[model samples]
Target: PLGYIKSISFICYPFAYGNPNKPKKMSELEKRQIEKGDLSCLINNQQDANILYKRIIKLYHQRDMVYLVKPKTLRYWLKSIALRDANEVFRDLVNSGY
Candidate 1:
């Protein structure tokens, strides 16, 4: 009763208000939108993009109070940062979970 409610709330609350740094859980419609989302327009190919998205979702499920920073956010992280290719970030994601 109370324990069940507590357990359920623990899972549901975070699902509702996920970590601010990561992408929020997609509704069925949003998932479809992402599945059909312009892969070429984003980073890397569909497969790599999907893998990184899955990793973000996994992080959302596994950790508490963790923040995720996107590759683009490096601008804010370091104003002097320079990169030759943006896809390198997603490539790293494929090679390493981050």
Candidate 2:
């Protein structure tokens, strides 16, 4: 169907139409920190923890991947996602956590 095709296109090509909302690119340091998501790396402050948590969740969502694992496993998963994917990251992890 036309709608189905359009949906697939939207997933594959986020800007299928005239929309010009290209995601902001993350810096190398920022990307690394996001992928790590290590609580230990986080500072002992609510702002730091909140920021890291949000990044990890956002990364997972943007990659269309779900990390249903423990803390260590999640770190591993996020690290891998960070190294591999180069797609523009967007926030889709809202209300799920973080």
The numbered model that scores best in TM-score is 1
List runs of model 2 lying over 4 Å from the truth.
1-22, 39-98
Worst 10 residues of 2 by lDDT: 1-10
Count of backbone clashes for each model? 0, 0
* Error of model 2, residue 16, in angstroms: 13
User: How high is each candidate's TM-score?
Assistant: 0.22, 0.21
True-vs-predicted CA distance for residue 63, candidate 2, Å: 19
Question: For residues 1-98, could you state the per-residue lDDT of candidate 2 as single tens digits?
Answer: 01111111111111111223544333456444444544332322346534533222222424333322223334534657654432323233344443
Per-model CA lDDT versus the true structure: 0.31, 0.32
Clashes of 1: 0
lDDT of 1 by residue, 1-98 (tens): 01111121111112222345654443556344434544323333246634542112112333322122222332433434323223443454457655
